[model samples]
Target: MKPEDIQIGKLVRKTETSSPLVECFDMKTNTCPIYMCCGLKGALSQAVGAFYGALDRYTLEDVITSENRAMLQHILLRSKLQPAAGDQDEVPDLMQGVP
Candidate 1:
């Protein structure tokens, strides 16, 4: 999905300006007890890491702009294609059709 399709919440906090760290929480509430142990958290952590890593390297005037948003999206997409920690050879081809 394009970045425009997603909604970014308020700035929760900023650790630094030069290498700024911003945190946003999903407004949607999920009451699932297993959330803490879920794969979703791991994936999100990876995505957030990649996003901040990019911010550290580039000086973006407007992060929500189409260009910047696309860059972030690309980072997320690339992260998904990578093999999970210590599971290089066992990684499944995500492009394959599921039966």
Candidate 2:
């Protein structure tokens, strides 16, 4: 699908990340006594808007390139096979970075 066809902001609208950039942004749920006077909320709101705007500009098509997908699969597989952080040296290089 085209990037603009995807609305990530709408998809995540009910999540905490949708508007809780600062407690002051959500009046109904905000418990902070000084929320009315908090100037930081405006800046944070703008920042969050920009964040969602950026996310909404792209689709999964923009992120999951084959090369990157293969790399991610390799990393996930490597994690499953490795013993522990300290035993990383003993882990085999499975697929030699291929998936």
Candidate 3:
């Protein structure tokens, strides 16, 4: 399917996980002192889950729309880190009208 044909808003799914950073931390070496009573880990996990859920709603086309493209360009120009001259040409010409 064409990128533009997909609906950006429909891809997101909301779900919660009971364990947050438990999988990341090693029990033997990186064990948290308050592992048993730590609410922060679960909360952090839920926050990350929510972030991904929100991000899932956008398609490539939705993110690269004309308005968004312009906004991105504007932000990039305003930022201190400018793209290299050679790298500028590597950017996809998504602004071009597709047949």
Candidate 4:
């Protein structure tokens, strides 16, 4: 089948193309625009690259991993224990310590 015939977000095996394809996301447009006709291999590589880039930039605190999820949950649960009696320190005095 031709690349134009395929819908966006549909993944196909790499062997079925005449040329390579490149995967790209247009953030300003808020759409993923894939260029076809480069062959399935190149397209697949681009898709893989995009995926890895996202995964790499995503932090553990973003709750991407099980450990992160558990840690966040624990923080939430612990926060409910008690309120501070005195005036709490507004900000950390980071300048007082060595980096």
lDDT for each candidate structure: 0.41, 0.57, 0.51, 0.37
lDDT per residue (tens digit) for residues 43-64 in model 3: 8778866777777666647667
lDDT of 4 by residue, 1-99 (tens): 322232222222121233224323323343343333335555667776686566555432332255454564556455532223342423222112111
**CA RMSD per model (angstroms):** 15.9, 11.4, 9.6, 20.1
lDDT of 1 by residue, 2-98 (tens): 2222222211113122222222223244556666566666667788777666555432223445556557556645765444445434433322321
Which has the higher lDDT value, candidate number 2 or candidate number 3?
2
The candidate scoring highest on TM-score is 2
Q: Sort by lDDT, best first.
A: 2, 3, 1, 4
Measured against the true structure, the TM-scores of the candidates, in listed sequence, are: 0.30, 0.51, 0.40, 0.28
Estimate the lDDT of model 3.
Answer: 0.51
**Winner of 1 and 2 under TM-score:** 2
Predicted structure with the largest lDDT when compared to the true one: 2
Is 1 or 3 the stronger prediction by lDDT? 3
**Worst ten-residue run, lDDT, model 1?**
6-15
RMSD score of candidate 2 (Å): 11.4
Query: For every model in order, what is the number of clashing pairs?
Result: 0, 0, 0, 5
Model 1 accuracy (lDDT, Cα): 0.41
| Ranked by TM-score, top first | 2, 3, 1, 4
lDDT of 1 at 45: 72
